[model samples]
Target: MLQSSPKGSSSLSDNDNSSDLKSTMNDISSQTNENSDYSILPMDVIVDILSFLILSKQSINEYCNFLQSVHNKNHHSIFNLFFGYKHWDIHKTHVVFLYRNFIVKGDLTPYESRNPSEKVEQDGFIMNYIFKHAHTLTVDYCPMTDTYCQSLRKNKRIERFTFIGNRKHYHSGLCSALRECESLKKLKLDSVYDWEFTKLFELASLTYLKLNTGMMLRDFPPQKYNFDFIVDIEENQGSIKKILKNEFSESRLKHLSLISSEGFTDEYSVSNLMKLPALEILFLENQKITKQSMRTVGQSNLREICFERCLNFSDSGMEQLMKVKLPNLTKLKLSGCGFNTSNLKKVFEPSNGEILNQLTYIELSKNQNMKDTAFSKLGSFKFENLDTVDLNHCVSLSSIGILTFMRSFSECIRTLKLRECNLDETALVTILKSCSKLQRLDLEMNNISCTNIEICEITDLSNLHYLRIEKNNLTDIEWLIALPLSNLQLPRKISNYGTMQLDRQIP
Candidate 1:
């Protein structure tokens, strides 16, 4: 196994990022033991992976598995099949591709089914190239032919599979072929025909499942789809929740995520998703659940809970959920949900807030309703184990309230994000003074000490190695020169004068 060095030393520009990723890929060829016999992959195979590596947009975690095939010589079968451009031309290429459960097509009109034969032929062509480097099969907008499923049964190398909106009949052969994939552990489904879900979930090897309907949900549509496994939000009360519980009750799932389309049912539901005995993480996206749906959140064994873009997930609902027995929770993220200061303050004001100290990462970004008063009130409490805090895009916040907010976790905080918060020099200075353990700081898109280049110095942030100061109001280059920086981002200024300044500084 190749060991990754500290990733804090890479440059921040896009061009530098490309070279850095290339260097990391080359490291794979050189890191293996010289005496060990291993298959040398052709250049095209390596380039297939490199095409997707955007160092500036991606993290070092993506490279951690580069050497997975080196130890097992048999895995060299991956190289036997050339991918992407092999035996194909530009006309067949339509969009970005990868091995994952999710991808957004650039535009549907271009790839819209021209004809059934052509579509299946294109899909089969795609499936052939997709698994040469990694085995994640995703069937979307294309029929699953016997050839591909038969290959899957024979190889049985696929560990994760995503089936979205594919209506092909799963005959006995197809089901048997899928069952042969004992390595499959994670499954994602957007749309499935009636009665097919029972056969799918019966796979004993599956430990993670997600049911989602994003982008096409009509307003106040029934929370329950016609399918037996459908799970939706409050409308006609607990009907959706009841169906969800009954459908998945017997499964041995460890992680579950429910994402409803961008609409909430006006009706209410009484039951909670926590009743699932084996669930460890619950992620809800774009669905509005009532307080009753989360009433027993404290009773679940969940260690992480995330709600993204779920409007009307009210502050009172959040307060009720936090007051329960969430002793095992280690991470919490609530973004794009409207939570105001008073209600936000109450979640961690004191006695009712002690369980929060156990969380290592917490993000309340995009909660535009939060103001200075929330953090000011929270300053009285201590978040002992919280290492990361994301207060990004909380425009209502200024330096005063944020300064007070930092007091609660400043001692233990390691990664802090204050992007788009419009902070000033005083608050930034206070952050440097207080957060001694900070390693990564993102203060992008802020007005922080933007105008004055003097009287503000961050040399005190001794442990800080990654800093994002892009889009600030700083006056000149001198302010950036004084720091013990490893990965530094230049302020956004695109004038001729800016170009000259860069030349002068470097030359």
Candidate 2:
């Protein structure tokens, strides 16, 4: 049933040569002593063996020994097929050359060496090869030198680029190199800063952008912090707002993620993001954003939105968001956002529970204030298309609230997570009987006891493929053997019972 592409096709002449190579290999294997001459083998056979060795992640000593017999031209061909720009059409192919590893053991010199001239020559070759053909590249903790930058400018075909570095090293030339990548579509920069954001706007083809400042303010004690750092953060926030408003207004960016950028305050930075017409996915984490900024985000055409650790976002702002009419919204996550049930009800059944009808995925985990009354009100609404619900760490939700919520979406819910919720055995039984179509369920760290009644109820989950009940007070798991589960995770204490039951059922 697997289809082949034109690039994968082999010519008739190549196949005949491969057959001859196979016979030669068989004759060599039958000989008493190993043969060092591999010249009789066809190019396809050598390439196939090398590909197999790399794909299997096995040691290539045998192949390396065989390559010694190959001619220089054939060696270049084999390397091209294995690691060079020969097969650009293969989307899954990626060439990752770590600077530290490359400098120590370049492609030609696979082993370590002490000669400085040889190291320099191999490094040059690696850089040239990557610049000429690599479409995707990831450099780790490597300082971008002037030569590297110049080489990057010539490589306009790079579609994905990731640069990971430390705070001590600053790559000043990265900005200029990025501007030259006209074909770039995705870029991730970590621990890099002070680059002209306006240059990004020139990349009209960019669709995904991620920038992590990598500064953990929490690590430093309050008294040890310098006042200038805070001032610089505020300044960066203003500059980011200006760049977004001026440069990204007409860009074709669809996904934008900003992490640990403390300068991204509510008024200027978040508000400017709303002006991006082509944006659809937005992720904000560890930033200061208020409810007022939510108003601008609600008006945007974003179909997926995630807000994590945005302490300024309160219930009132959520109310404003729920009131907005977003026809295309489908996914929403508010993890670690200390909003209570009253605000959540507004989000679920906002504006008479009519808006966000297309919403299928909802995550309200770590909201300690979500209680029974909230679910009681939530159950009253009709989310006929709801698919996944995550209420993990909502410790205030008791059996009553959980039962009410489960019953509401029992018909359509396919995945449900209630980890660390205050659900008892009765609540677990109710969920089992209600969510008949549930395929994945996570009820870890609860008070549920796996009694006979609970086991009987679990047997009814015919469609369940994954079940996690770890850290619960499960005592009886003998009946778990009857369930048709592809994956199951039970508490450590009850794992012995599960193992014994499986052993008895196996043969």
Candidate 3:
């Protein structure tokens, strides 16, 4: 009878413990239900959160979580809207993610622990999956093995391909695969050698090409042809004529960009470059381009030209360039070319008065020697279609010169950058008053100090959305309080009054 009583007590205790466990689980489930109620959030709020996660750089785990969230919400439509259809397709975004994570960042720790052959196979599988639907691809610092190259050959729809090669590893298979991409239209190769241009030019569908030779030709093997091989020809005319006689003569190539490459110092190279009659855009950066080269470039049917750090290009080079009657030329950029005020006049006011009537954009940044005289002469020229101008770091120009220049181009100017220029309060006011159509203005690092009354002039710029006036001596705060600015950069030394004004006005 005593043993039976003990067993009954044990059963009672077990029952009580079971009841407590069930109660605790019920409380936890209730709390979870309360936390999982994301339905209260508006659709726009959820979309904003997702968009931020997609655009911002995040850890792989975070990205996976975002993808899972996106899947759960069935909000794949946000990707289409976030990355505009014209800029990116759904497949392009996926490829970008793969490239950014695995190639660019070199974050392959998860796969590195695997066996070598297994890792290669896994990488190939992942790459094939991502690139199966991609139309445009850019590869930088990522060496392509034979397996990957063979996979690339299968993508017949790829239109644009950019490869920035690694110096340590040369992948011949990749180049061989590229040669078979009959549908490719645009190709960009950087720091690559041993390429057969004859085969590249054979790509009848190719229209755009960019070649950047970061290392000198002497560093390459004797068998490898430098990108500047065209310029290396002693008889430039004959070489160019030969190319014209070759299959490339009828080639549809239109845009060409050569950067940090050698062999463009002489007239022959220049003449040879100009022989490409179908060329429409030419970009020369860090090249030894002389006056003769500029003349040849100007003779081309090019609609746009960019020259950056072309130290050999002097006033005479600019003069010769302006002399040509390039009716189709509309955009020009001369950054860090060391051209001065004197050269500026030659281009703007050539004796022939053959103005760049179609010109719409001009950039003359980092021309430290440019001063008031240059702008004064520029004002005399007729830039009827001029809309955008960047004169950043042209520190020689003072308030008077800038004021005069702005007043001249006021009617057509829409975007202006005067960063680090010697602009004072008067110049700033003058710009505000004259550039009625100005949409963006940058006056950072200028000597602009305005009184409360003087600052009122800013209100007149109704169309201005971006205004950068940092490092200025602006002491007034009241004028900025009521302005409907979409973007604003204030002076570093904001007074207490200014802080209070901003706090009160911002909300």
| lDDT value for model 2 | 0.60
For model 1, the local distance difference test gives: 0.58
Q: Pick the TM-score winner.
A: 2
lDDT per residue, candidate 2, 139-228, as tens digits? 655556677778878887788887777665446677677888999999887765553433664688999988676545554333222211
Quote the RMSD, in angstroms, for model 3.
Answer: 13.4
lDDT of each: 0.58, 0.60, 0.59
Q: At residue 454, what lDDT does model 1 achieve?
A: 44
Model 3 ranges off by over 4 Å? 1-134, 153-155, 169-173, 193-199, 217-243, 261-271, 350-353, 378-380, 451-459, 479-507
Give per-residue CA lDDT, model 3, range 1-507, as digits (tens): 001122112222333454453343333333333234333444444444343323322222233343345333332322222321221212122333321122222222224524677655545555554344346776655655676677677777777887776654446666677777888899887755544533565677889988676556465543233224333334664543223435456667788777756633343344455556677887888776688765544356778888887877865677787776677888888887887777666666534354455778888888888778875655455557789888899888787877766665788888898988888767766677677777778888888665633555565655676677777776765556555454444446655431221111222
- Note the clash tally of each candidate: 4, 0, 0
Ranking by TM-score: 2, 3, 1
State the displacement of the C-alpha of residue 115, model 3, in Å, after optimal TM-score superposition: 6.9
Best-performing candidate as measured by lDDT: 2
User: In candidate 1, what are the lDDT values of residues 1-507, reduced to their tens digit?
Assistant: 111223343334434465575464455444443342323544554454434332322332333333333642322222222121222222223333333322322112222365776665545554544532235655555444567556667645567777665334222244556666766788786653332333555565678877664434442224332222333345564443333545556656678676665543221331334555566787777775655556634366778888787776767767877766766889998888788877777776776566788799988899888888875556568888999999999999888877887898899999899988878866776787688888877887888643543434455655776666667766655555664443443446645222211111211
Segments in model 1 whose C-alpha atoms lie over 4 Å from true places: 1-135, 139-158, 163-183, 189-202, 214-250, 263-272, 450-459, 483-507
